[model samples]
Target: MIRVAVFNFKMLPTRAFDRFSLQIAISGMSNQTDDEEVHVGPDGTFRPTPQQAEDLQLQLDEVEQELHQAAKYGLYLVEKNEELWQTIERLHVEHETAQTEWKGEMKTVERHLYAAQQERDAWRLCVIPLSLRIPLSSRKCHAVEDEVFQLQQSLTAAAAAQITMQMHRRGSELRRSPSSDFVGSRSVILQSPPSLDIDLDVLKQAVDDKDAQLRQALAREVDKDAYIKRLQQTKRDTLDIIQQMKTAAAMDVDVRRSMEARHAALVDRLSAVQMKLDESQDALQTRLEEESRLRDRIEDLQAELRSQGDDVDAQTSAIQSMRHKCARLEKELQAVSELAEAASTSATATDAFDRLESFFNLTALGIILEHQHRIAQEQLLEGSSRQTIARWFREAVASEVPYHAWHAWLTQRITGKPRRRFFAKGADVSPSSSLAKAIADFFDKYRHDKKSPKRSLESANPTPPYS
Candidate 1:
């Protein structure tokens, strides 16, 4: 039995059973079966004693316990492997989700970056023209200011000459009929040159009055010049900011766009203001010319009055005509004054009809409307057939369409709807109806006529019935 147990131990897998434990079991079995060796033959075949059998059984039980312990350990390993595999699968799923989220986030970032780039490009484009226009506009404004200054100087000179002439007339009248108070006071000194003393006093008073008036006019002109200079300076500062933005490499799109819009608005306002100034200058020039003509006529009449001193009827008629001319000039001056006041009071009212009462009186409105209609007709006729122009003008007037609306209609008729740039709004220079009306009025009143080449529009055109 001991030999059989040893043989079984040898036959057991070395990898599954401990060699040391197996040796011990075999040795113990051998010790028990030592006495049983008497049954052994020389060929090694033998039977065991009862004690040897018990020892063999005990070794078998010990081997079985070790085998059961190894199987339990293997089962524990298999369960741990299954847990590891589950963990790996869960980690893989998490990694895939993370990758998908990263891709989506990247796409969103790319889309936003593309939009920002496009907006930046649009602002850069808008800024380029504004930068270029600033210096040119400033130069033009300076030139206009120079012209206005020259016109003012000439007006002052003319006024001075007129005052001198008036003084001369007053002196002559004083010499012809001295004041009773002067005669009574200087009766004794009247022996040699009675009129000389009175003439001196009258001339002195006239000169002082004229000088005061001239000073006041000059002061007003200076104030106006200063105001204009201030406006120009502000405009220059705005342009400088725009230029700086243009030079910069990058800027916020919303800020750039707002600045661009503000610049455009400023340009439009400046242009309108320039137009008003030009019109005002022209009106001033016309008034000066008319004053010159009137002065010459007055001088001629004075000479005639001296020569025909006894012809009261002709002199009265001449005086009446002069009075009428003076009244007309005064009316024109009042109109000019009103226009200037309107312009100075508000920068927003660059277009006509913004303040209807400020621009057009009850008497002037109809004639202004007629003149506007004529201008519209002329403009239309220049490009299209006369029949079409006439028809359109007539229809516009009949419908009581505002000038801006009519201009838009005419523009649409001539050209298709105005094209806009990518990411840009409508055309910048589209004329307003009120602006058209204002422009027509300005031209009608100030533009020189083809006929009577030497005459101004105010002189060449027939006076309106209301006037």
Candidate 2:
């Protein structure tokens, strides 16, 4: 028993259980402790192997720490449930009270409902007339209409901005082109005729003068300003087109929606009218049946009167009833006529749509061209300042022409690519021949440009040789 207690001591908690187990072992008694955290007794306690018992106690301690947190969360949820239950009970009590009140008012409500039913029947019989009717429109239409209007406004503003930018760019370009008083720069100086063959001293003076112009141009940043103006204009145009597209987009989604709403309202009106007509027809049918039965009764009464010697009171009452029946039938027929007209009109109005604008408003070439121009400026190129001219030339041309090829044609020269690349097998190609051909083509193009400059911003009219 002492050895058994020593082995069981491993299951102790807080090291204190181990001490108690040691005492029990020495005393030769197996007794449990009073602590609630751990109960070593046989009842409500699991006995484990000594190794298992030690592991279980360690796990329990870790779980107890976690339980502290879980208890708080559980308590919070439990409190919430209690509050919710209380609220539900309160609402249930209020509902019971309302039900009692409703029960008390039921008689009055039934009286009103009966009155309405009689009134509706009278309308069917043409005794009471229906004047006011609901129109086919939705509350949501107002909300969406405002948003579409705003989008249209924004698109219009964007287009205007683009137009302003274009005007400014043209103005600046006009100013820069062919200004006799304008000074030259290193860039222009380098491009000047290579035949100058001036001695180094004379060339140096021209270089200095050109350098001064370059400095002035740089400080003033005319190129940069022009570039900025062009870019802004392009962006404005794009944004405007996008705005117009947005309006179109809004209109597209709304077109169906507005129509649907109108359709729904019209359908509702149509349904209401149909219901009214059905009611009137049903009443009319009933009246006709009654009149037929009355006619049969009158015929039978007349036959009886002829057989009887005296029946004046009965005859008088029968005649009055027959007249009332005829009058009721006439009223029903009128009601039926009115209801049929209303139904036909409703069907005609609900089933059709009317156009508000001329056909093909969006497909106009001018709008498409402006739209394409704006998109190209904003998305394709960046910060060239020559964006208008550059983008137009680039996209308008055929894709088969390479960019370098165009540039080579423009400059009347090619570098970084020597003519030797093109060859007859085992034979050397002459650079002079390639150069000569290029020069001839350049003159030809120049002559064509002089005849008339095409109104394309992108196509360069190489300046005509001064006559």
Candidate 3:
């Protein structure tokens, strides 16, 4: 009841006459001894005693002074509230500006992080393949060296065999002509022993055959020398390639190290930026909470002021708008955070793909290197043999035969089969005439003459026929 009466008192108009009348009525009612005692005049007006009227006037004066003081205080509160609202607006604007700047910085950091990841991935991809390739190149070199060594051994055996055959022919001649000096000037005009009855024409022909055999052997020796030189050159080339591969590997390692250092720096920078972003976000959250609380306080003050019949509806609507704005800003911040996270994840995936690409590139490089090495080895092996064959054809086969025909004939001889055609399609040689058989027969006669003791004797007994 007292609370209701105080509310009614505050709701009353600040009028001196009205307050005085209310006081008089209250005093008259309190002074009544019984409920039946009359407190009102016949004219329906409250009649008070002189003391009650003076006391009511004094009470009226006090109430008017209190009302004036309350008005001044309310006005001061209104001014302070306006200043507070201005401060809140400034703080909200600053918060929004800071949030915008933070988001920009986050985006920049994310881009940097992504670039760093790509570089790091590239480094990893390049390094692993280079690391594996070094050993493979070394192995290829070793294999090439082994193959060259084998070729050299075969060439050496061929040379030794040729030397032995020459020595055997010389020894056989010495045995057949017991009195002739093998290397003296008199041996140039050889004479037959008394027991041998050889015809002059037969001996001369035999001597010509032996000379041809010796020439053929010398030609073979020359071919061997050339073949050895070619092998040596191939070996040198392979060594140079190996050295280059080593240099490339070393360079790759250095590049990888540099990239790693750069990546580490970027990671540190990214981490620092992330930390700062987190701190900014946390500070923003705290500020938002504080702002929310301030808004609540303002809303409470506005409610109180509204209850007191103050016009604060416009201010309340502005505060609500600010709340909506703050909520929107928070959502934007969350979206930015999600974007940063997605960027980070995408960067990670990009790095993985880069690594995979590097792996594939390395694998491709390795395959290419293997293919090149194989081709080089084949070329090295075939080059010397082809050169040797070419030299043999040039020296042994008369220049009358075209190189293609000689090559075909040689191939047929070595393979022990007839060729489709030894000469070009339009050649004058009949199809029935086997060029391969002809070459084989010539080589057989040449070999037989080289081995025959009669030929050796005729060659060693190099004297002019008995005239």
Best by lDDT: 1
The better candidate by TM-score, 1 or 3, is 3
- lDDT at 384 for candidate 1? 38
Best by TM-score: 3
**Residue-level lDDT tens digits of model 2 in 1-467:** 11333343335565676345434433443353333133255664434346545654575466556766787899999999999999999999999999999987997899999999997784464432212111112223344455455655655565556556755665575577676533443345445334233333354564556556555645545454465556557668978999999999999999989999999999999999899879756744643453344345434443543454354453454334334433443444444434534554333211111000000111111122122222333321221123332333343243434332443332221122322332323434222233224323433443443332232222433221111
Q: Report clash pairs, candidate 2.
A: 227-385
Q: For residues 378-449, what per-residue lDDT tens digits would candidate 3 score against the true structure?
A: 332332232333443333223344322443443343333344442344334422123223333433443353
- lDDT to native, each model: 0.50, 0.44, 0.49
- Please provide the root mean square deviation of candidate 3 (C-alpha atoms, Å): 59.4
- TM-score, each model? 0.23, 0.22, 0.25
RMSD of each: 53.1, 57.8, 59.4
Misplaced by over 4 Å in model 2 are 1-221, 248-256, 305-467
